[model samples]
Target: MRLGPGMDYAVAEFPVPEPAPGQVLVEMAYASVCGSDVHLVDPDFHRPEMVGSPGYPGHEGVGRVVASRADGIEPGAVVLTVPSGRFGGCFAEYQALDAGSVIPLREGDDLPHVLMAQQLGCTIAALAKYWREGMRSAAVIGLGSAGQFFVQLLRARGVEVFASDVDAARIAFGREAGARAVHADELAATVAQAHPEGVDLVIEAAGLDATRALAIELVRVRGVVGNFGYPEFQVGTFPTMAAFRKAATVEWFSNAQGEPGQWCFHEALDAIRTGAIEVGHMTEVRMGLEDVPRALAITAAHGEGAAKITIAIRPESAIFEGS
Candidate 1:
């Protein structure tokens, strides 16, 4: 399929390849639509490609290792593979993965299933970057999949968390995910009332310009503001002077850096497996590969109804028929 501008996807037949040394072939079972995928689909964020060359785009995918040149990852092993920006092809039925980048999934492992690994990893990395000792209050702006995950992480760490979103449905979802849900318009007042001295941490997962500024304003002195959302191709202005004066640390997290080199995936997996984070609410939508294009559009246009949209690639008969 071609992820070209104005063309969300176009089917093309191709031959399946064998895994090379130290690599594995994953028959993808599920792939989640990330905020970055939406950005890539925007014309403003468009990048030129080399003539006649194909670029595969996808990072968050879960599947079973159907074939491998490595030892422990033999056939039928469920795993999560980290494909680099250019050659990472998770949107397809079969994805070639480097052995080192694959994390094995045990049989009946509820924690590391297709629905949990990718988002959990990203959330864990963001939390690790901004979490602090003695921090007791947090506000998560934007209750998308990431924001919901942040709410769970904060609450798990014993912090009082409030979640805000323009969409009421999203706010309700946040509440179900264990956050004190509030609307965007009421966020400033909510934070002010909850913390009085300002919240200890403000996680800007909304990617809106207004929310970005609010994150800076709502954070307490010496508090941390972590920006984890991928806003559309646009720059946002914030109260830099106030943030500086308050000694607030504004950190921008990109999952682009979290593949194999960084422990983003592993950290998220550990958090999910240990119950330090919750993924049940995040997997709100499930569809098959045929729904990829529409799923992307729905996520891009109206993200209020979903936390995470999982794309199932394998049939139930193939994975657990006889068992």
Candidate 2:
């Protein structure tokens, strides 16, 4: 599927991309829609930049390499292809990606759920920089998949986690992840009353600026606000009154910085593959490749009980569907 005008998505076939030197041609088995992909489709933040863009907005994918032009990497290898451009887009059935962009996966590993590592990597990369083993407490705003992952990861580190979301299902997921789940309406007051001094850190996973600002209000004096969510606006102002008053440190969790060695993604994949962390339960929704437009809409709309919406490109016989 390609991005059409006015935030529309329509299916169009493209030729199988040929691998250049140092590139690999992957026949995608599965791909997942991400929240950032939603920002790409929003008219307010879009401008047909990649017109006829082959997978212009998709990045999360797991597939098998059919051909390789790079040394050491071989054909028929199951890999996670994290493409950053049009040629390697995963929304299509095939992706021609740079050798460095593909990470090998164990053959028997469930490919679809492995897609979570792509998003997981983004979170852990930021956490690796700032997360301490025994912080006083942390608040994860926005109980989307990213927020839930933060709650799960933070709780494992022995920190108290307070989470919020408008969706009841996501709030429930946060509770299951061991967080003190609260509705959006009660988040600020709940955490404020509980901690009083504010949380040690705030993981603002919702892309809204309002949430970004709210992170400041919820964070402790001089606390960190790791901005993981993509802002939906092209150009917008942020409320800094809270941040200024709190002497807060706000940082955006950048995915590109995680690309140099791809160590973050590597670690995420290993954790998921080894059962060090569970991502299977997080991938709760599945749809066929043809439903990408609908899938994007569902993902863009935030949540209606959806967690990690997937586009299964291959036949049912190809993947071991989880229970």
| Candidate 1 wrong stretches, greater than 4 Å | 1-8, 46-56, 84-87, 110-114, 234-236, 255-264, 270-276, 320-323
Candidate 2, residues 88-110, lDDT tens digits: the string is 37888887888888888885777
Model 1 — TM-score against the truth? 0.85
Worst 10 residues of 2 by lDDT: 314-323
Instruction: Find the candidate with the highest lDDT and give its number.
Output: 2
Q: How large an RMSD does model 2 have? A: 3.1
> What RMSD, rounded to one decimal, does every model reach?
3.4, 3.1
TM-score of each: 0.85, 0.92
- Score residue 151 of candidate 1 by CA lDDT: 86
TM-score of candidate 2 on Cα atoms, chains taken together = 0.92
